[model samples]
Target: MVGQWSGREARALREAKRMSIREFAAHLGVHERLVSKWEAGGDRVHPRPVNQAALDTCLARSDDIERTRFAALAAPEPDSGPRPDAGRSAAPGGYSNDAELLALIDTGAARGEGLAAISEKDLIMAAAHEASEHAGRAEGTNIGPSTLDQLDADITRIANDYVHTPPMPMMVEMLRVRRRVYRLLEGHQRPSDTSHLYLLAGSLSGLLANASTDLGYLDAAGEQIRASWAYAEISGHNGLRAWARGMHALIEYWSERPHRALQLAQNGLQYADSATAAVRLHNIEARIWSKIGSTADTERAIHAAADASSAAAADSLHDEVGGVFGFSDAKASYYAGATYIHLGLAEPALAATERTIELYRTGPARQRSYGAESLARVDSAAAHLINGSLDGAEAALLPVLALDEDKRIAQLEERLTGVRRRICAPAFRGVAEARALDERIEEFCGSTATRSLPPGSG
Candidate 1:
């Protein structure tokens, strides 16, 4: 009979059952990595008592043929003598068995259980106590509290940086953190840890989705937002759910599906749990309604966003993690400006854009999103051009024309192109000032981020 079972015997049981490491771990309700640890530890490592009991139950379920094979594989070599502790009395409790013995011997030395005069029973007791501690640690989570804290902090920093940082570098950092979260998810973790990790994954995916959209990769952005939505669902985070829906709506809005975008924004409202989320959804709806030329609906959405903003409350995703996930007054004003431009309300568009630019300039330095600010200038320029004020339009477009090439995003170029089109229209076709402004805008659009991307990359 096999007097005791260690990692070697555990490996034999796995082989006897003709099971792969994953299958064996699944059968025993343990992590695959834990199974690998057991097999790799060989004769030196013993599982905790609960895992030992699980092992016993697993072996008992084996058929006679599997048991025979297990016995043969588990038997010690013929030349091998008795184990050093063979003469000791059988361990009490469930450990008194034919095939396996388990204790905290691996961690017991630090507790003075390794001293020469210690009785076997005392050693077993110490080992059993240690095993209980180990089981608690293992079953609770694989990740440490500090690791989760660092990940949460990283997400917050990334969110804040997204507003000002270039998209390509942010995407790289996002992918790296996403990979870490994905790896943590692959191993065993507590339910709470799993939920926390999924939230992080969803946020990172949402950022990637925005970056993809900015780079003109609508299909890839769609995939990323869908993944974000899935992770949000798994984590049961209402804030992430609302945010993901808004991102999906944004992608569809840029894809020229205004109706679908409107529907998505409205649907996202159901998941909005905070003022910021509600305001974000309303603003998105406003933009889409304006895109579809529904002035009354657009006005209603803008009003709704204002009302929501008045009821601001702390939200983990938006307020607590205030970066790209946030909806600031400046951004909201920018959206209103853009909607006014779409509805051809030159006076209100100019007013809204002026407010938008003022808010960005006077707000927290970290909250200033250069791309949004530039887009506001473009909208202001468009309003001036509509009002037949070439001088006003030129003044509005000064900063936009001076932006670095890498800072020139797709939306910025698209807005500038709109201004160029207006300048090229019949009313301004022969105006020398409009003609010069049009040429400058054309040059500005030529060296944009999307244009500079490697061939077919976007």
Candidate 2:
């Protein structure tokens, strides 16, 4: 297992423990970037001896019988009294340090539900005290309900502009706003005002989580998401709760936990009544089922998404958070195309992508999200390539390739890479048209790599 480890195994082991790359790297006393390199390399890369030894040691401890025993083992056992001192807080608003917080998360995970179910009255009070301690670091700015409302609007703008805006600037702005919200909570205010501030903090944390994920800092993303959920719980906002759950599901899906993603999406629906978040959650489930190649489940999810979309429209409940919380006609079509692709239904994939392209073309320029449209085109081009229509594939991809570097995202880069791989099959390897396509892709990808920000920007 030492030298034979692959990226799949590496990723699976880390995910199995719910530890992010940075967490795992720290566990091994290595750099986070090295861990990412190993995971990204898949089977092609192997670790040096020291890392191999560490990885083997990690794997052994991960499955250490005493550590990872069946939860059922405790079912008939007597309840033990509380330990002498309770573990440190993992809650963002509560914890004094990252190491203590993470150790707490892991310890709780080993048990059932961990600290997530801990709702002692003292938790928020501790968080408030921590906020007060750090209040000195916050910039001096008077704030109230109006400021919180403006924060909400600013988050929405950032979410909408996420695709085209440079991530560093956006992430910096989000952090600045988050600090302000935290400091406001530190000060005394009316109960209603406190609730509003919590809402803003929760939403801002969720946005920061999204940006962290986009920059490939999964550990940081996980941290922000935890904070988001904590704030959402404190605020008692149904919409924010649903959005937070949906975001969690989305991250899990991206992290290769499709079944868990579906479960989270289902849970989110409990708070989603005629809310646009329902549509987003349903689409997430649909995508998960598609990955699992379950036609019946996929169909059910798609139908639920359509029904939810219709209800949200009738109720006039649009998602104010545009990036991940909302689904456009183009986005839905693109997702459907992705589902069909995973299901090996080539014709359906093609049709869905065609619809997506149509929506992007006919929709208002301002409404056109570059990320969604580019992904749809990549899907379209891939469908064409699958069907042996090289000309059509190239034509479909021209618009995507012509987009400016600033508009390109990691997701788009990934899809384009997949497209290139498909077109490089032996059947097309020597074809003149295939060669042209490959060259174009190489040039485009090279530019993208060069222009890309250093990983972990957020």
Candidate 3:
């Protein structure tokens, strides 16, 4: 079953029906833009709940031939018809399957083979042999290599999609995938396979932690991050450990616990083996230091981040499975801008924000994060406000103000709140332009992404 269709499945279904994007959208009663977005999202993006239902209905109404085409397109793999020993009958001296093997044991019991007649050591050896036979029948793993590969791919997709996709849809996908991982973990597997599963679980947990933080559920985020940390430890994955620690530090920072956040970030530095992870930790530390009003410490951390970024290295978590786990130059600049804002360094903040915006624009199309870009815009506006250029501030915030409400994350709202406060300062008091901008910001904050999240999402 093509259950809970993602963009990949949806596109496959469309192709199977031999319909273009416009035709598919018309059939599904949605705008063509949404279909394009889904197709662009590939396997990572999920349509809205209503659209998901529409897709489900469309698939349900498909004929067998169409379903066959979808199954082929959605999952193209070499056929290995069946297991080698399929339908083989038992030989006179041996069994063909587990059931036949069990029957052989029962026959022995029927021939007056009693436990009392067998020596204790011999019986123990027999039991061990039987268990070994069962364990060695095929493979101990409930999942095959292909399944693991698919899981790995899905994890990478989710990680890459987290920044661009809406939080609710991304969270839904995360929860579904996490449950699949949990079910796999509940079954028996080789130690190596178990470790891989744990690593995936940790990554998903860390992502969920970040989502929870974005939704203003600090307590939930804290619990989720702890689970991520535990999974990372079990998996013995240093990269995941570092990323989880960074996420925890971010949650603490937003919770207004600068000391705890700093401690977390400092501890994570030890596990940050890759340049990206190290840079992320250093940037986090710089932010915490800024929050603590320690300009020297903040500057030192910022320089450390720059040093770390220079020594670029591939990391399993940050580089290979990048999305929210990544710390790009643009994101680093955004972090620096945010830190500068807290330090009241308007000039540096403006410079950092400009670099951030430029990098985001000029970087790979897939890597451009709207949320990060919008936040940078807010930071730029804040710097302008600090410089007493109301016109510049207003200009800087135009893009942010134009953002879709669904993309207006809590952090963006919080930043805008700060900007509004700045606008309400004595210098801007009684100014009609400032009052108008303030009102607009207030309205924007009123309907944020977090606020619109469905019930029980956390």
TM-score-best of 1 and 2? 1
TM-score order, best first, reads 1, 3, 2
Task: Report the alpha-carbon TM-score of model 1 versus the true structure.
Answer: 0.75
User: Candidate 1, residues 1-458: lDDT per residue as tens digits?
Assistant: 34456888898999898766777899999997788667756787799988888889889899999999999989875766866435443433212221223332333432443344345564575467647755765675569869999999999988899888888888889999999999999877888899999999999999999888877788999999999999999999999999999999999999999888888999999999899999999999999999899999998998999898888575799889978999888998898899999999999999999999999999888989998899999999999989988899999999989987777888887788788888888888788888888888888888987788787665
Which has the higher TM-score value, candidate number 1 or candidate number 3? 1
Model 1: which residue pairs collide? 159-323
Across 70-159, the per-residue lDDT of candidate 3 in tens digits comes to 989888434677533334333332333332333345456313444333344433554676577556733557888698899889888998
Q: Estimate each model's TM-score.
A: 0.75, 0.64, 0.72
- The per-residue C-alpha lDDT of model 1 at residue 191 equals 84
Q: What tens digits encode model 2's per-residue C-alpha lDDT throughout 1-458?
A: 44466554565566655555677798889987777666645455677877878877887776655324322321233457643224534353233333223334444542445455444533455456547644643433356547766877877776666655656577888889889888888765666777878888887888888777765566677788878889888988777777788878878877888888788889988977544778777887888898888999999999988887767331212365665456677888988998887776779999998998788789866566666777888888888888888898899899878876655555666678888888888768789988888888877876552256666532
Name the lDDT value of residue 363 in candidate 1: 87
- 282, model 1: CA deviation in Å? 0.5
Q: Give the poorly placed runs of model 1, Cα more than 4 Å off.
A: 1-140, 454-458
- Tell me the lDDT of model 3 at 337: 94
